[model samples]
Target: MEKVRLGIIGLGAEGGMYAGFLTDGKVNNMVLGAICDIDPLKRTMAVEKYPEIPFYEDYIQMMDSGEVDAIVTCVPHYLHPQMGIEALKRGVHALVEKPAGVYTKQVRELNEFASTKPELTFGIFFNQRTNSLYQTLKKLIEDGEIGAIRRTNWMITTWWRPQGYYDQSEWRATWGGEGGGVLVNQAPHQLDLMQWICGMPAKVYSKVKYGYQRDIAVEDEVTAMFEYENGATGVFVTCTHDVLGTDRFEILGDKGKIVVDGSRKLTIKRLARPESEMSSSMSMQDVMKIFMGHSGNDIYTEEVLEFNDAFGIQHISVMENFAANIIDGTPLIAPGSDGIRGVRLANAIHLSSWLGKEIEVPFDEELFLAELNKRIVAENKYPVNA
Candidate 1:
């Protein structure tokens, strides 16, 4: 009970990162308990590197080994839910990685199972949730700093991965393996942040390009439109092929607007009065001044917010919070159940693109899965040997 012994399932890129964090003592109140990987090379590497910690090829054995009080699922997109379920069944706290799963249906199953284990801490690696910029923006929206959102747009295409990146692993961009391309891998954080701040959209319409730049079968470029229940609308654009891409997210409300660039600089402009009222009551002369850029200080207040070097804090804070929640009842920053929101949004985007029409927020899971299976079957027909 002194410190949570954490076992990591998968020693790939993400698992290795978590292992490094734990072994480096970057996360407090937690220590590396065990490691698991089906790859013999990873198992050998882990054994040689961390001789004190037990390494297992079978994750189930690691969970049942009584060495770990909690576990983090750092495996593939599809395995996240199933591995989490297995950990929960063994009474171990579970923290999952992003997107929850390949689809909403599987993630729902995990969440439904986790609901019965209230005694255990269940969380997701929505590390971006710990970012101060998004946190402040969420608060501003919730506190009515920007009235109801009129429109929101985010163009986050800084996730530029070369073809070799996908070629490094067989499961990198395959439908049955990684599930999808940019949406599933690179843009989940933005998807989570969008809904976290502005709430989930009522409908989604998208235009997607499959393997447009890369040699993969899944989408590599996408531009999606969102319609909210409150008459608010949003646009989300992302691709992994941009070399010098943009990372700008803007949310415009009736009374104010918020703009974030590169996830670092944040600017908020609060109007002197709501745009609705201003449009109705402003004189022609005042409008002329505003149009001519003569109305300066009296129009609205501007504030810029920035947090330095929070990249490390994002992941470390999430890990520490997960441990603290298990230790002293601290609430999770990103609950495992909340993981489904991002998946749902991603699924909606993919479905909209596939169906060539607007898809409802709670889209048809059966239809989505059926379409997904078709692609998976085609992918498996000529599987890449990684």
Candidate 2:
């Protein structure tokens, strides 16, 4: 087996986490060939952790060196599309972090670039897809255990970030650096999960607040209503202000309801069993007992193991998929094209809040881009002088 040589850019929080996986030999069949970070301290820290691997200050120089087969970009939200596009142009597979880009146009460009290079793989890391509970939920839905989901709701408030956390990095909360607050940063996984399970929305109405929790310019609290194409309604509520928070997803269907409260494990209330199997006469108590027995466990471990099995253990599954697609013709888990949905939805929410209107889906990309650029330019006026 030819080991895949991997390079990593942006040694921030999630970057370091991926680096740890590579260095710890948790992921197999991949070598950490090189690492790059603009920060001198981060570069030094990475060198210290993996002495065999070379470090570079400039990612372009690292890419030019021709030392890596794939690049894991854990850079800021705005940089994901550019870096990923550059990697594909260079014939290097790219695995980018979530909320792939700041705007829809950039994502479309990246996807078009990747499409032209069919040999190149491009993947976005929406790691929550690996969670066991989520997998089970998806499976149940797919299996028609919940008949035609009519309504869904997710309250994701567990992403509490303190003032010090945002203060630690100049790019943390600012629009110019990170794009948006909880929606762009922390809630991409949740958004991706929603899209994965419930599919895209046809219409959206949102209310967003910036200083609801902290003094940041981007929204910290959001309540968005979604009308799915199938006439199913959904509500997404997220906040970084809640000190005592909860992450919950509930799907209400004609036949039953599936509720996943991040704290209380997973629960399913089946209104009625399948007619074909009704002869079993398993009472509601028995059904509840069975459901409880099979509910939440440490699914994260399972996700990691699956990632290891599919792609080399050291490689992130999404990145591995990208590499495989390039090298051996595999499919992308979350392609660059699929990456824009969350950010588009987030932007719609922001736009709706700003304009005081219910933003329609399949929004005007040019208009949104211009508005976002204007907001970024305005915010950058008093840039964080880190």
Highest lDDT against the true fold, candidate: 1
lDDT of 2: 0.76
lDDT of 1: 0.91
lDDT tens readout by residue for model 1, 1-386? 76899999888878898889899999998999999999899978987899999999999999999999999888778889999999999999999998799898899999999999999999999988899888888999999998989999999999999999999988789898888999999999999999988999999999999999999899999999999999999999999999999999999999999999988989999999999999999999999998999999778899998866544778889999999999999988899999999999999999999989999989889889888888887866433211
lDDT of 2 by residue, 1-386 (tens): 25677888988877777777767766555667789999889868877788888899988888878888888887887788889988888878787888888777788788888889876667788766656667777888888776888999999999888988788877778777887899898898888889887888888899888877797878899999999888999999999878889887889876677788762366776654443354366578655765677523311111111111233332366545555665566666677677878877887887788778888887888877666667678786434211
Q: Candidate 2's error at 306, in angstroms? A: 18
Looking at model 2, the pairs that clash are: 27-313, 27-314, 28-313, 28-314
lDDT of each structure?
A: 0.91, 0.76
Any residue pairs clashing in model 1, and if so which?
A: none
Q: Find the candidate with the highest TM-score and give its number.
A: 1
- After the best TM-score superposition of candidate 2, give how far the Cα of residue 250 lies from its true spot, in angstroms: 0.4
